[model samples]
Target: MRARFEKQLLTLHQELIEMGSLCEEIILKTFKAIEKEQLPNTKTIATLSEEIEQMEQDIESRCLKILLRQQPVAKDLRTVSSALKMVYDLKRIGTQAYEVSEIVAQGHIVKSKELHVLQSMVDSVREMVTMSIDAFVHEDEALALKVIAKDEEVDENFDTIKVLLVECFASKSLDIEHAIDLLMVSKYIERIGDHAVNIAKWVLYAITGQLDIDGGE
Candidate 1:
């Protein structure tokens, strides 16, 4: 019975990794679409989104099964609960990527200095998402903490974009619609980083047997 329970836990872990990888792919492709000023490849994004949703459902079902059949306790219970939370975070990240793709499809292209800043910000968050998941898979508390710490950088870049966007709106130098779309794009990227932080928190919970709301606790 113990061996069977461990096997189920491993299955859950693998499914989480698959879902995280799909979300990362969507984020990278969405940024590529933005950089090229082309409509994002929605077909791929849609397919991945569907796959992620299915994975979330599968993970939830398996977690419930484990709770009922095995009655997981202590660290095992934390692992199952953390897996549930991580799937939700991954699903939100996927949604944010889809939102960005929709903005790209609307023919909004942010150019010049602002575009560079936005691209850099996207790249940072993408890296964070990848690192946070990797840390969880490897059970590396240090890497998980690093993911949480990097949120500040994402926030700073987001602030810079907001200021530039406000100035553009005030000066009437850029199309207001375009500016708002770009602002939303920045916001989506920032939210992605926030989701990555949430994943890091889950990783910590799985490892330390404690929950930290502030991430530093």
Candidate 2:
């Protein structure tokens, strides 16, 4: 029974890695679509998001089966439960990426200095998402902590974008519609970072069996 349970856990970890990779792909596609002024087939992004949702459902079912059949306890139970929680965050990240693509499809293209900062946020959050999944698979609390810490950079970028947008408004430079679209894009990216932080916290819980990560709420 223990051997079989261990195999199941490994499968779960691999599935998560696959899901995380998909999320990363969509995120990059969304941002690149805007940056390059060429919206990548919105249909493709939407399909990726749908695939992520289906993956989440499969993972949730697998976790429940493990819980009912194997009756995992202590760290084992935490690991399964954490995977369950992490899927929701991953699903949200995927959906948000799709939404950003929709906004981009509507001709929301931020350029120049603002685009540079947005790209930085995208890079940081994308790293956080990847590292959070790695931390979970390896059960590395230290790496998970690093993922949580990276949220600060994402937040700062959002704030900087907000300030820049405000300046645009004050200077009567950027039109209101364009400025609002840019702000929404920055906000979605910030939320993606938050989801990554949540995944990292769940990773810590799976390892230490304690969900006491600061700023995780």
The alpha-carbon lDDT assigned to residue 217 of candidate 2 equals 21
Which predicted model would earn the best lDDT?
2
Instruction: Flag regions of model 2 displaced more than 4 Å.
Output: 213-217
lDDT of 1 at 88: 82
Stretches > 4 Å off in candidate 1 = 214-217
Question: Model 2, range 1-217, lDDT digits (tens) per residue?
Answer: 8999999999999999999999999999888887787866899999999999999999999999999999988999999999999999999999999998888888856465777899999999999999999999998989999998899999999999898888888985667777888889889999899999999999999988778644432
Q: Using alpha carbons, what is the TM-score of model 2? A: 0.96
RMSD, candidate 1, Å:
2.4
Positional deviation of residue 28's Cα in model 1 after best superposition, in angstroms: 1.3
How many backbone clashes can be found in candidate 2? 0
Check candidate 2 and list the clashing pairs: none
If scored against the real structure, what TM-score would every candidate get?
Answer: 0.93, 0.96
lDDT of 2 at 38: 83
